[model samples]
Structures are given as structure tokens and as C-alpha cells.
Target: MRLLLCFLLLLATTLPARAEVAGEMAAALREQGLTGAVWALVTPEGVATGAAGLADAGTGAAMRPDHRVQMGSVTKTVLATGVLRLVTLGHLSLDQPLADILPTVAIDNPWAATHPLRLRHLLDHTSGLDDARLWQVFSRRPVADTPLMQGIARDGQALRLRWPPGQRFSYSNTGYTLLGMVVEAVTGERYEAWLDRAFLTPLGMRDSTFGFVTQTGPGADPRLAMGHFDDGSTQAAIPWFTRPAGQFTTSAADMARLAQFLMGDGMIDGVPFIASDLLRTMGRQTGTAAARAGLPIGYALGLQIRDRHGVVGLCHSGNIVGYRAMLCLYPDQGKAFFISVNADSETASYPALDAILIRALSLPPVTPLPTAADPERAKWQGIYTPLPNRFDQFAYLDGLTATVMVMAVPDGLLLTNMQRPDRMLLPLGNGLFRQQDRTIASHVFMEDADGVSFSDGGQSYQRVPAWRFWLGWLSVGAGLLGLGWLLLIGLWRLVLGPRSLGGMVSISALLALMLPAPFLIWGQSFLALGDATVGSVLLAVVTGLLPIALLATLFLDRRRTGLLPWLDRLASLATLQWLTVLAVAGLLPFRLWG
Candidate 1:
């Protein structure tokens, strides 16, 4: 009894000193303007966890080691871990065709008979499905009456493969969502439950949970910190039905444990949890994922493989509405780092902390991004389309940029981003480039027989054929002219009064609604307006009546004057041309009734 009392006093005294051990890391977070962050570092030597700033910005709660955070896409690692366990049991195979497993869900694979998408495609984000772009509107509350399977099936039917399977890397959350459904179909168990039993419980990640992350719920643990926005505004907690993709909530300590399991011998409490070899397999690059010099960026199964001066590491980064997270493991060093924060706007800064942890742990610092230019700029010219995405947003807008010109200038090239007409890209050698002085290494230039494959870091774009390229420009010019005509007619009506022009006010007003103003008025919020809204129905009605108004004016003129003025004639033609442009460019993203 006396020995126990003396040991307790000694241990309690040591804990506070250990908590203050990573003061340097806490200082880095403060320098980056992060509001709150929980970071845990595990090494073969020992484990240390540090958190700086408030756990809840609203309540001024001091951060704690056990505060839970939404894991965002890092949940993919957990999903992958569970699937690999099934693979070890002989219940599933990594190379097994996904179609063979989830037949109830319709997957639009044009080349399925030739190159069927295997289960590995889901893990690697190489499946030809869209990334569920429109479905982001369903983030908090999805469409009523739609289950995960139905949503996946509906999206699968609408989105065709942008490229052949295993062609190149294109991240898709829809693919991971489908993978979650596959897990349910085979085991007849819920994904979160299976994770808890197979992975979470075995790995001893007690704080991890799924569905909605909040301070209160039937199974709520209020130890989870409230999330905040970049502006220091409190963010309301929300649910994600897209389970496998983003429905994850965990703590730094629990994440560190998961990381420890990955780097360890795969035995916990003297029983093999998962094959250590399989976990290692999940850490390296897979399929046709490219590698650039100085920057080790490529996707492995559910992890991102990063190489810094040959110090290899497996990592993944994640984000929810108000929270962000990152986890990386260095097997060579027998070390792992996990950190998550409570603010959404500050999440991008979280990745930088990975480098800080690496250096602090005595590993090689991350390679500095390249800056030199490649003089051979002409080779970079081509008509590029956005990398195959589930959402047609970029494809439509970029397609209309009229086969964007990548012409060689004295120092660099002029490029169009669908939004900007011409932005100069200064070539930063090693097949990379940048748009502006303040930009990070933004462009990665890779070429093949199809054309030059270029990535602006966010989305991938490929060169298009000549004819389609010209059509894009023509369509864009027509759209601009059509918008100009509408504004001009409205101004003319304001001066001349609505009494003189018949059907002019209605047509002009309808066209103006098409410019996102109506969407803003009708959507639940500004962010929601990009897709659909309460006012979308009225907007769609106006759009549908547009051609009728133009045709009515055309026929009425045919019976009236002997000759029409050139401006009127051009206005009439431009209106008709604009509709054709919308159709050709595939910008019609919404249904009139829907």
C-alpha cells in the first residue's frame, strides 16, 4: 500500500512535464493562426500528446488530450483497414471485380467487359465514377427518403467513367461511398458497427464513432470539441450519410493508437490484429499514380505516399465542414503523427504541421517546392479539359473556355481557368508551374498520346481535339454576347419605358435570373445555391419559356416591318445561339422540375 501511494505521486508529477514536452509544435500552431489543435506523436521511444488553444472557441474551453474531432477523409484509412481484414479472411479479394460484389448498385462502366473496375479501384480512387459533386448540397441534410445505396445507384447511373480504369489518378468520394456499400452487402452488417468490432475495438480506439458528430446524441460523448470556422465563428455540427467517405469522428489519442498499430508488428495484446504486411501494402503507391521530383505526392490504397529525400511515409488528410485532420506514418522510423483542429478555414495550414512534426521527431524535413522554369514552353501547349470528375461543373465551364489557349509567351504561357480569360503561368521546372507570385507550385505537366495531362493541384485537365477546341471558344463568345444583349435590352427598356416593347421585359428578366442572382434568392444558403434551391423552380420556368419569347418576337417581326435593323437581327440570332451554347457546353446542370 505504501509503495502504491509513492508510485502514484511519482507518476502524477511526470505527466504534466510530458504534456509540455512539445512546446515547439504548440508554438508553430499559434504562428499559423490556428484557433485550436490536438496533436499526438508516437515513437518507438515514447508517446507524447499536445494541444494548444481552446477546445471550443465559443465556450473558451481549454483543449484536452481526449477531445474528439471529426476525421474527415482520414476515415478512408479506417475503411481500408477494415476491408483488408476481410481480404485476409478470404471473404473478399483486393483484385475482385466490384461489379461482381455489388450488383444491386448500377455502376456505369462502358469498358467493364474489357477492364472491369476491381475493388482496388475504390481504395485507390481510380474508379471512373464522379466525386459526388452535386451531393455536397446534401452534406447536412440529404434528399429525403434516399438511402446510401439508392443515392450511390442514382449517381452511378448519371455519371459515366471519365477515363478507362487505372488510367490515371482522380480522387472520387463516390468510389469510397460505393466501397462502404460493398462492405454492408457482404457482411449484412452496418459499416460503422463492423469498424467498431473489427478495427476500432481491436486497435483500442475507444473514442471513434460514426454518423453525426456532435456534443449531444443518443450515443453522444460531449468530450468531442465544438468546431469553428476560419473567422472564429462557431460551426454547427452536422451529419453525413455518405458513411464511408466522410462520416468519421475520432480523437488525437485514438488516432495515434491507430497509427501505432499500423507501424507496429500488427499484434495487439498478443493476438494478430491485421497482417503487418497488408498494412505496409496499403502504404505504397498503387496503379498508374505519378511521382514528381522533390514532391512525393501520390495515392496508395487509402493512404497518400509521400517521399521526402527518400524518407518514405504513408499519409492522408481530411476535412469536414468546420474541422480538419491529418495522419502520417513513417515505418522506417517506427514513428507516427496525428493532428486535428476545430476550425474549417484553418485546415489547409494543418498539412504544414506534418513537416514540423517530421523535423521535430528527427526525420528528414520535407523537400522544398521547385521554382526554376522550363524554356521549352511550346511543348506545354494543348487544349485541356478537366480531369474526369463525377461533377460536370468544371467540364462544362472549362469546355466553354473554347479549348483554352496555352500559347507560349516570352517567359511563360497564357491559360484560361473558365473564370479568368487569360492568366500567365510561369514554368517552374521539373514539369511544374505557378500562376502568380503568391502561389504554391500549382501546375504539374505530364504528357501522353492523348495530349498533355495538366493538374492545377485541385483538378486535372487534359488536351482536347482541334474541332471540339474551337467550338468551346465559339460557345463562350456567344454566351458573353447573349448576356450583353440582355443587359442592353433592359437598359433600353428602362429609358424607353415598358409600354413600347412587347415581351422584352419578361425575356430580359428571365435571362438575368439565369446569372445566379435567382439561385441566391431561392437557395437555402449561398453555398447551397451553386446546385439547387427553393427558387430554382421559378428560375427553370423562366429558362424554359426563353425560346418561346424569342420565337414569338421573331414571327411578329416577320409580319410587321419590311426590314429589321442589324442590331435587332444580331440580338435575335445571339439569343438563339446562346441556348445552343448552353446545350453544347453541357452547362445545364439542373432539372426544371427538380
Candidate 2:
């Protein structure tokens, strides 16, 4: 009787403390313009769940802990868990080649004879597959009931491998969708039904679901929170084509149960739901060169090994159209937390909430040991550009701005890039390095058939010659200057009386370049380019014709000897050179719909 009384007193003191922390998190969400948020924190002591703001801003419905929201890519974790469970049950093998599992699915892999795509590569995103293309993500038709094989056939171009399988890491939603297909291939059951029966029910996540949820149907969940944009506009629950990759709707209380199950010993009610050894393997990556070089941090199976405020944890963040979610698990310390916001606000303070929760739990910090400078740092200095992008359609833009320069500094190397601030890489020996602010080794330098390259697990950068680097920038500069000059000359000629064919060509070039600006400025959605519309069709036609116009202008004005003609010819040549670069980069004919 005395022990029971003491336990009750302890619980009474902790509840108020937890409530106070929850209040602070709510305030942080409001300050960042998020309309609604739900969070769950699980520790050895107990679990705390809370909600704040309005679930439906228009209807004035208050958010509740049981309200469901789109979990986005966090659904990958659940799918990966299902795959691992199959492995444990002897129904599948991680190293099994994808061709053996789905024989009819077309895959374009140059290394198929040697390094065939494997189940492990798909799970860890090292399968060399590109992410979803524009049409796949922004389909004009409803995707709620589209057959998996049909969808795969429609977007077969994304199945082309960018590199050898299991060579490096690159996040690919298409890879996860393939894994879902594998689940069906093996079990002869839909992935959603199998996952629900095998994992969700056992874990007691009753309110969570893996399929699309509607807003006005008889089966619609009234507890579903309405998704919001940064501008306070609401979004309807639209089904995604890649259902297994990012289509789960779950509640905070349900996520808290999942966190507890993940942090535990794979046991529920004294039954082994998953083998402890297999569960331990889910947090460590093994299919990449960086993993082979003893790098400890990366995207493993589903969760990412992340360092937050000096504490190492397994985490996964999710973002769909109008929702963002995060799940963080510190299994070593027996702590975990899940957070989601209805509004995909640019100014949302996720890091601030992370800090507050970390402080609240009093998690221990990690400090890296001091190491000697790399003796062979000179070999690592050079200009490097990221190889095949995650999205094939944007590869040209990525090559332009994502190049980086690695230069040797006093105690480390400085990584200079045009898009971000310079970062210092401190050597941790054996060709592995970490950023100055990071506690774990996150960068690896290695040599492959393509020569020396560096990787941060997700993207790899290959060394390029100094001359090639300078040539690329010079060509871009000359093209921009020529276009500006043409625009001015053409406008001046228009104001004055007679216009030459050269002046008309200049004006046409200017219009081609500026045609897509208004659509981008007003529509503010990449989905607009994914399907045939007036804007996209016009862009395709103009871009395709601009080069021909410039070439014709150059040819027709060749015999003319006046200063104006000569200058016009030179400008056309410059613009033509730029167009050649774009053509080589695969940007000509700009057919974005496919």
C-alpha cells in the first residue's frame, strides 16, 4: 500500500512537467505559422501525446491527439519493416536480384550481368534508380485504384539505372515502390493488407492505415486533419500513385506506439514479433562503398542515422503535398519522438522543436575524438560535380549549380559550393571525414572505375579537370550577356521604323527564354509542368524553334558586311553555342510532361 502511494505521487509530479513542455512545443508551432501539429514522446518512464492549433482552420475544429494526418515518406519505415519481416520468416532474401522477383518489369541496367539490382539495394536506396518523374507525381488522372504494374509500365524511363547497383546511395521513391511490388510478388497479397495484418494490428495501431483516405465518403474518417499550405489554404486528401512509398495516414497516439515498438526488443505481449538481431540491423547500412569503408552514418534500410545536437539517433522525415512529419528514435537511450504538422510552411521551426524535446529528455551528447590530419590530403583537392541527379529531368540544372571545390586548409579541407556556405571537413583517417559540426563520419573519399570521387552517402561527386570547370562557367556567362544584348537591340529596333530578319530572330529568342516565367511566377507549382497544358506546350514549341531561328539568322546574315549585321551574327553564334551546351546536357526539346 505504501509503495503504490509513492508511485502515484511520482506520476503526479511528472505529468505537470510533461504538460509544460507540450505547451512550449505548441507555441513554437504557432510562431512558425503552422496551423496544426501533433506530437508523441516516448521514454523509459512513460509515453506523452499532445496536439495543438486547429485541425480545420476553416471549420474551427480543434486538433486532437487521435486526429489522423498524412505521414508521407515515413510510410517507408513501415514498408521496410514488412520487407525485413519477410526476410526473417524465410520468405525472401535481401540479396535476391530484382529480376528474379519481378521478371516482367523492364529495367535498363548496364551492370545487370555483374551487379544486378538486389532487394537490399532497393530498401536502402542504393539501387541506382531515379526518383519519381514529373508525370508520376503530378498525374492528371485519379491514382487511388491504379494497378501497381500499370503504373510501373507508364513510368518505365525512371527504371533506367544511373550507376552500378550497390555502389552508392541516392534517395529514390521509385525504389520503395518496387519494394512494395516485391511484397506483393512474394505474398500474393496486396502490400497494404499484409502490412496491416502483420504489423499494425499486432502493434495496436488501430487508427493507422496504409491506403488512401477520403474526406466525403461513407468510410471517411472524421478525425482526419485537413492539410494546409503556408498561406493558410487547405488541401484535400489526394491519393498518391506510389502508395507504399508515401500514403500512410496515422495519428500521434499510433505513432507513439510504433516508436515504443521500435525502441523495444521486437517483442509484444511476450511474443517475438521480429527477431532482435534483424531489428538491430535495420539501423546500420552495409550496401555502399562508404559503409564498406567503416563510415557509421547513412540511410539504413528505412531510417537515417542522423546527428541532432550532438546526439546520434535513427530518424526519418516525410514531406508530401501539404504535410510534413518526422520520427526520431534514440534506441540506445530508450527514447523516441514523432512529430507532424498539417501545414507545409517554409518557416516552420522543426529544429526548434527538436531542440526542445532533446533538452526535455536530457539525452546524452556524443563527442568525436581528435584525430591526426590526413597525410594524403593533397590528392583529394579538386573540382567535383555531382553525378546523375535523383530527378533525371533536372539533371542539367543540378550540374550547373551543384559543383563544389575541395581545397586543403590548415587542419582540414574546405568544401566550397555555389549554393551553400563553405563547410570544413575534418579527416577521421582511412579516407573518411566529417564536417566540423558533425559528431560522426559523414563523408568518404574513394576511387572507382571513374576515378577519384567523394560521397556523403546520398550523392557522389566525381573529380573534374580545372579547364572543363572554367569552360562551363565561361559559356554560361557569354550566353547570358549575348541574350541581354539581343533583347536590348531588338527592343530598340522595334521602337524605330524598319525591322530586319536578324532583329526578328533576336526578338523570337527573347520571347522563347521568357515564355515560362509567368507560369512559374503565378502557378508556383512544379506539377504544372508534368502534364500537357497551354503553358507547357508553348514552352516546348518555343524552345524547339529558338535554336533553328538563331541558326537561320546566322546563315542568312553571313554575307552582309554592315556593322549591325556583323554584331547580330556574333550574338547569334554566342547564343547558338549556349544552345549546344544545353543540348548536350539533355535540355533541348524540353518535353517535361513525360
Candidate 3:
């Protein structure tokens, strides 16, 4: 006990306090089974930058604030500024429909409404477009089959209208891709090149660039801070086809400069980078408070606007497979905070970091939870769901199933994926709660005598009865068993009735078809297709059904019961083939709808 106290005291005293924020941040990563690199900057007058842990744990290189790391969705904040600059220049307008900008380029499946998706919708992420990707768009090589717009059109056309245009907010990466196209159309330049000329060059951001991972160059060091999985194993940098949406690389110094630019009212080094009117416009409320209440304030163009202790600020966060970043600017106080992690644990460091910055800057921090707000209390307990958006379900996938989680936190509640529990949401008075670094507005719960309903922004979900889980599984098992019984009965009929070889082939095909029948009947859009392969289907028929039919022939012959041995071998192969098909199909539901 003495040794334990001494150790604790030593740790408390020795850990970097302001710098220990990094250690606290690092500890947060470790607690969630994640490890990688972190670059954090808390600026009172100038930036105090620090790094903790490894850039590449496998290589033993210590993380440095100077080391370049992927900024993920932080790129969106910058790109949104660029797109808005175009809008402010009379090259585009927020009210103008997207169809007017690039008349020739089809948007694919446009929302059927009088008010088509506009530049405001794209910048603030109110566009109803389903998130889709064109892998070829971000490729260094020429795209052969799938073009970005074509894929958008194909998938977008099929998507059900989740919400009418601008009726409810939904974050769609596809919207940014559309905005990227607008940049190209208005500037007569490629999107990345325009970013270089408009945002990076003007701001003198020397180290930042977009699509470095996909673009061929010696520029992006593959040896830079590597992203890691929750288990601390390395994660490969994702190849982003939508560069503007979530792809950029920078050092802490560069990000700090960007933060300064945002905090400085769109000016850097005396040269006006963007009009101040444009900056304010970008931070303007695009969605209503009632529509997006749980949010800290509301989403601005590529930024979330909210007030901490009555100080209104603009902020944004980024996440890719292995990276996460948060950037904040307090315009009223002329202060900013930037934090990035190479191995993202999906923890909410923004709130903690915000508190630290406010304290460090001598500005009042956001109101802290009262001592009375015990997390252990039942009033703060219950399952809460976040607002509906594109990334909500996909953000949290369990082993092979998707799950909605309710966070039971002190003074606040969070509903998140099993994977990302750190996105804790605090009630913003009334039923509203904030999520996504407090940029998104949403509500927590609506209760009644029957059960609880989880709503975000405006959408609602009733509690799924517990029995539905078992009943679902039971139904699937019964379906598979029933198919098996049909197969056995068919085998008996073939043997007793002297069916022809053609009839036998037809029966085999039928069984092959039936093997996947259960999934097609009861699968989600993503799972119904499964990992189905034509070869697997063929194997199922040849090995399982054909042999069964042949065994029936032998049983009818009675003298040919000897052939049952060969029939048994075929039946075993058939079973193996069907099991493989079913296994692949089973895995699909977990991936898509889990």
C-alpha cells in the first residue's frame, strides 16, 4: 500500500500537466484498446505543441509534433472554406440548386422536390444523397469501369429518400464530392490544385496538401505516423477516392497555422486570404435549432458552430480508418485548439481539450458537471440513441453485427457504436444533446408508458423488443432445416420415381438455388448479395444434389445399393459447398446492417 501510494504520487507529480494533457489523452487511447501517435496544440498566446508514444510502434520511432500525419476529415474544413470562397465570389450561391452549377454532369439520383440540393446543403451536409464511393476517382491510374459520378448516380438513384432536401440534416460524403465538382466547374481547375491556389498558398501552409496518399509522389512519407487498430496493430492508410471529403496530411505546426487562419478571420500574414463576410457566412447557421438542437449550436460550412461558456466558436473533426483530428477556433477570444491522433480510439477528447484550452487561455471553460451529477444515478441512466445520419450505423460495428449503444456517463449520455464510445453527448437543456464534437444537434430520448424512444435531431426509434433477437435467429434456423427436409424428400422421390438424367440435373440446380434462398428472402440490402460466388453455387449443385439424385436411382435399383458409397462422397462435398455459401452470406449481414 505504501509502494502503491508512492507510485501514484510520483506519477501525478512527474506527468506533464499541460503537457500531461497529452498523457491524459494518451491514457484515453490506451483505455479504449488503441495506440498510435498524437499531435496536440493548445495555444494561449502561441502554440504549445507535444507528441506522445510512437509514430510507427513497429519501427520504434517516437511520435513528434513535426511528424506528418493524415488529417482525415480535417481536409473538409479547409475544402469547405475554398468552396465557400467560390460562393462568395458570385461563382456560386447557397440558394442556387446544384443542377445549375454543372448542367452537363448528372447528379445521378437527385431528390424529387421543388427545392433541389443547393450549395448550402453540400457545404453544411444537409444533402439527402446516400454516401457512395467511386474507387477510381482517387486512383493515380486511369479509372476503367466505375467512375465517381456514375457510381453516385447508380447507387444514389436506388437510395430511398431518407429526408427531403434540407428537411433534416444528414452528413453525406457524396455531398462534398459534389462540392468538389463545383470547385472544378467554377475555377476551371482541378479541386486539389484550386485548394493549393486558394487556401494553402494564400495561408502560406507549406506542409499541407490533399490526396497525398493516392497521388504518386515522394512527398508523403509512408514512414510517417502510422494508424493503428484498437488492438495497437498497424492500420494501412485508406485510399480515399473522395479526397476533398476526408484526405489531407500535415504536421502540428501546419495545423496550428490553419487554426490561426480560422481564428484570424480568414487573414494570414496581412494578405486577405478570404473576405471576412465570407468567413462569417461559412460559420452561419445553415440548419435550424429545432432541426438540429442537440448540437452545440449548429453546423457551419464544413464547421460546427457552438458556444463554450458563452464564447461562440467554430470547430471541425476528422476521422479516417487510422486517424482522427479536431480543430477549434474561438473567434471572440482570438484563441484556437488543434488535436490529431494517428491511431484513433474514437474517444471524445474535444470536450476535455476544450476545457484545458479555456483554462490555459484564462478564458472560462464550458460549464463543468456539478458534483451532484453522479453518473451512477438512475436519472442519468438509460439507453440513448444519437441523431440519424449516414455514418451513424456504420460507425459502430461489433464482431459481425452492427449494434446501437447507449452511453451512461456522468452529467451526459452518449449513444455510439461498440467501437466508438467516446462520442459522449451531454444534454443541452431540454431534450436536445450534442454529438460529433458538438457540431451536430440532436435530442436524446422521448419516453412514454410503453417504452423509450431514442431520437436524434428529429428522427426516432422505438426500443427493439428483446424477443425479436431470439425469434430472428430461430426463424433462420428453421428455414435452413426446412430446406434440408425438402432436399431429403426430393432425394427419396428421385429414387422411387425413376427420374431422367435431365431431371436429376434440374434437381441439382434447384438445390443450388435453394441453398441461398433463405438469405435472399430475409437479408438486408447489403447482406442479401453476400459474398456469393458463381463457382460456389455450381459446386453446391454438383456435389450435393446430383449425388442425392443418383443415390435415389441406386435405391430404386436395389441391386445398385453399392453405389450409395459414391453418393455419400458427393453429398459430403455438397454440404461443404452449401456451408461455405451460407457462411459468406452470414458474414454479410454483420458487415452491412450490424
Best model number under TM-score: 2
Residue-level lDDT tens digits of model 3 in 1-594:
999999898667544555666766567555545554445454545666677677776677787767778877778888888776676567778778777886765553445556576778778766655554322223223222223354233333443334456644566777787777788788887777778767676776777776455212444475457886555767656444465677677777777877777666665667565677777765555454333433334566778765554345677777776677777777776677776777766443445544554454555455442222333323434433323445433322121133354656665775655434456666555555555344334344544553565544323344544465344445455545544644674587587965544335435644665554454454422212322333334334444454455445435444333454344334434444444444454432222212
Q: Give the TM-score of candidate 3.
A: 0.63
- Please give the distance, in angstroms, between residue 477's alpha carbon in candidate 3 and its true position after superposition: 8.6
For residue 479, give model 1's deviation from the true position in Å. Answer: 1.7
Question: On residues 1-594, what C-alpha lDDT tens digit does candidate 2 reach at each position?
Answer: 999999999999888877887788778877888888888888898888888888888798988877888878999998898788888788889899999999888899999999999999899888888887776677555467777765554736436898899888888888998988999899898888888888799889988888788555667778889888888988767766677899898988888888888777888899888777777877688777878877787787788888768888999989887788889999988898898888877767677877777777788889875666688987899998887567767776776688889998888889999877899999888888888888888788887677888988668788989898889888988887777777788888878936777678768777777787677556545544576766677677788888898887777667778887777777777877988888887777676676
Clash pairs detected, candidate 3: 16-20, 294-433, 294-442, 295-440, 295-441, 387-456, 402-594, 442-457, 495-552
lDDT of each: 0.68, 0.81, 0.57
Full candidate order by TM-score, most accurate first: 2, 1, 3
**Candidate 2: how large is its RMSD?**
2.2
Q: On residues 392-483, what C-alpha lDDT tens digit does candidate 1 reach at each position?
A: 54566546543455777887877865555577777777677766532345456777666677755335577777678776567667756865
Q: If scored against the real structure, what TM-score would every candidate get?
A: 0.81, 0.94, 0.63
Q: Which stretches of candidate 2 lie over 4 Å from their true place?
A: 1-4, 153-158, 216-219, 512-528
Query: Number of the top candidate by lDDT?
Result: 2
Sort all candidates by lDDT, best to worst.
2, 1, 3
Better of 1 and 3 by TM-score: 1
Q: What is the lDDT of candidate 3?
A: 0.57
